[model samples]
Target: MDPDDGEGLFSDAFPTRELPPASAFPGQDPHALGGARDNILEVAIGREVRSFRNKLGITVADLAAATGLSLGMLSKIENGVTSPSLTTLQTLSRALGVPVTAFFRRFEERREAVFVKAGEGLLIERRGTRAGHQYRLLGHNAGNTGRVVVEPYVITLTEESDVFPLFQHSGLEFIYMLEGEVIYRHADKLYHLTPGDSLFFDADAPHGPDEMRQLPIRFLSIISYAKDEV
Candidate 1:
């Protein structure tokens, strides 16, 4: 898939509203879709990023310097103007002392039940080459509870993509290989994953796809965290 090409594999967009609380979903796990299960993960990246920044009282300039990114770029990312690359995200994680997963948190519990169906996943296609490809919402409006988000996705390497940009966010990520194979790049390390194989990693580590992509890879990913804790 061409990064510049806007045509997505799943053409239809998913329907979404605010999610219910973590308790409503049970297990404090975001990966568990209670009703009408589908192949996607729920992510509130925007809310998470803002929460972390606000909590730390970090300015865009401060974050840019710490992440080795330009102030303008960092501002764009925070303001929803641009999507930071995996590498850019890693830089921020290192500077923040929080796991890369910290970039994906929500401070409030969800109130409504939200569902993302196949062929209609909601996405945060912010300005930038790298988009926050959120497959589903873990839970929402639940008062300070925890939940997990499980999603299925395919990583298609572009001819221009020499490496998967390093990224970190605000939770734990469990990746289960489904189809194809690719090198999974974690901070200063690389791991090859195949079908049925899985890996658990800290969200704050700089991670992304390895450059040696011989095929389009598919995987099931679960992200989990407690909203109240943050």
Candidate 2:
């Protein structure tokens, strides 16, 4: 199927929202949210890249040559010290002989529904404990049907950094701020969200949260992706 065809699928599956202008967050630079430091998503990508490279008996230099990236840059990416851009991830995907989706966690089985009482969901440590980002998986598909899968999670953020690593995938993402405030960055724009405010957009766009305020800002994130894409 043509790659562009998926855009229609996304539109049909999820309702679109008009995004506010980047100036919505006046005087805020989206680039200021991230730097040489790593976030959970970057760490996960780094680990996956290293694992795939090692499994193929490939060296950093070899990967650098294949991906046309500098050895130093690749090293920083692999060490979770820096995050790669969409173009960089695509290049690495080609070099590793895998789809870009391979960098994300995989969920196989499908389930009709799942329930998690307050404070009872599985606590995931993707960003590491020191990062002060808490992610709890609420539910996901557990069946074998190769249809679109929906996974929901509750995220608690305590990081005070102005910048953060961004991530993208082949899917749609919906975020609803539950408590406190946060600056949600999508591509080149930033949206300030408060309790009850929600944002929905294409997941393939590089996006993340920055400038989290209030000791612990909590939100609900729902990720929808085609099962076959995994």
Candidate 3:
């Protein structure tokens, strides 16, 4: 084996094929999305993929063969040159013998109990550039075969106006006000909630904070979704 022939090693070990351009994927335009070109999520996914492959002593060629993806496409994905779609991610996860969520964050083995200390949760931005909203993922059900999908988060709202668009998802949501006050809007109705107040509603119905009073307000939000839905 020639030490200088990196691509040749893979070609000799497995069959090679040409991959379509990034734009070929549905709704993906490599030249159009500037911010997504090197976004944090893409970078994180690439890093994890590369790390996992290396840990398994598998070369890029091996991964390409296992995933039925072109070597060039795999290279681009591992290098964060492009973001993989959900289908592509699922393929990779299957090839790697891990769940799709593994690309997002590390997964721990199932434990009978878990603990999260105050101010120690992982902050996540699920809503994209939404301002005045801080979300800290308190915890998630771990293990690959965990049936229930429960995600508890600490949400802080500082926006005084209700200009933000309502958001909805498929699941049940419960919110318990912890500090300050806010007008919570669900569907077409609004309810004022203060400390010790709680609201349970269908997450499918559009809901958001109608108003944030007493400056910054903190609350606990627990969302439950079917395991398959996750």
Over 5-52, each residue of candidate 1 has an lDDT whose tens digit, in order, gives: 234332234111245776675554545553332111223444455567
In the order shown, the candidates' Cα RMSDs to the true structure are: 21.8, 20.7, 23.1
Give every collision pair in model 3.
none
Error of 2 at 82 (Å): 63
Model 2 CA lDDT for position 188? 53
Give the lDDT ranking, best first.
3, 2, 1
TM-score of each: 0.40, 0.49, 0.49
The total of clashing pairs for model 2 equals: 11
User: Which candidate tops lDDT?
Assistant: 3
Candidate models: Cα lDDT each: 0.56, 0.74, 0.76
Which tens-of-lDDT digit does each residue in 62-148 have in candidate 3? 999999999999998887778899999999999888888888762232235568998989988776226657889887874546667
Candidate scoring better on lDDT of 1 and 2: 2
TM-score of 2: 0.49
> Model 2 over residues 1-230: C-alpha lDDT tens digits?
22223243345444345767887868746578443233367777887899999999989999989988999999998877787999999999999998998875421212245778888888876532345567799876746465888879898876443345376777998999899887776765567788999988888978887566554788899989888777
